[model samples]
Target: MNQRLNRTAVVKRAAELADEIGFEQLTFTRLGRALGIAPPGVYRHVSDLDDLRRAISHNSARNVAVVLSSACAGLSGHQALSALAQALRDWAAMHPAQYAALQIAPDPNDTEGQEAAHELISVFASTLRSYQLEGNDLIDAIRLIRSTLHGFITLELSEGFKLERPIDLTFERIIIALDAMLRGWAV
Candidate 1:
């Protein structure tokens, strides 16, 4: 533990490294090497590997939420939904690990982690409201859209598509299908 380092810097670098090496490959030793500190020094900033993972999750959620929210700004209904869909895909393409981080369920007692997750979902929930959906229907809609987008993006990131069709075209069709679903979903 030499030189000065803080949890914030450590977390930031870890998140970057997560995007670089995949979240599973991220390790304190690698992070330490990048930070020019001993692996033990990371303990000074974060309690342990799990704690650092939590911090990364929180950071990733918050960042993704902001990106998605901005993408849907001043738009509603199908337009908002489409903006959100494309933005999410673009963000995931750029930061697959961070996007994957959003999939990690927050611990029940982790308020900060819970809040970050909620904010990301809220972005989708708000856009769905444009279709005049609410109550249980709204919750279901959010889950559906999240699941749809998550499944598609995950497969795409993993190169599971393996088709000759342009990926963008498939994504656009998905947005069109979602728009149609939401329009009828209002009833």
Candidate 2:
């Protein structure tokens, strides 16, 4: 706790606070309290609440891209897709608030944010290359995968799945379906 607090450290702590207290509840005041400093002290690391949120968003995107890239490493086709899907779901389940942060569109003018976002898409595109997807096809496939994962995770996080069957089974089935669709994709 005696370590010097910098922007990276502050943002890392803020991400933890978000996971613990929910992203919507994450504020400079709360982060400052958690850091054992006055609320105004947070301004040294982040300009304001929006700045803090943007930092958290960028960090969240990086975290997710790393996870997905690691999962898909040395894998291809259905194996790669399955690993990526599982990684995405596991990351979201483990860090709901940080995962929620990824839902926010990054500032178009922010280079770091743009790079982090592109990193994620690059992972997906690399994995889907086995399907011979390129150009608009690759873009569409990325959107499909992202939308499907986001929709399912959002619902799961909100406890919207009211079913007698196990949720894990459903998630696995969805991945299987996605893999099949991608294999036969034409457009």
lDDT of 1 by residue, 89-161 (tens): 8999998877877778999999999999898888989888778888888888888899999999999999998
| Stretches > 4 Å off in candidate 2 | none
- Candidate 1's C-alpha lDDT? 0.87
Model 1 misplaced regions, further than 4 Å? 1-4
Candidate 2 at 32: error in angstroms? 0.6
Lowest lDDT sum, 10 consecutive residues, model 2, at 1-10
lDDT of 2 by residue, 1-187 (tens): 5258999999999999999999999988899999998889888888988888888889999989999999999999999998998899999989999998888788889998899889888899998989999899899999999999999999999999998999999988998999999999996
Could you estimate the TM-score for every candidate?
A: 0.95, 0.97
lDDT, model 1, position 122: 87
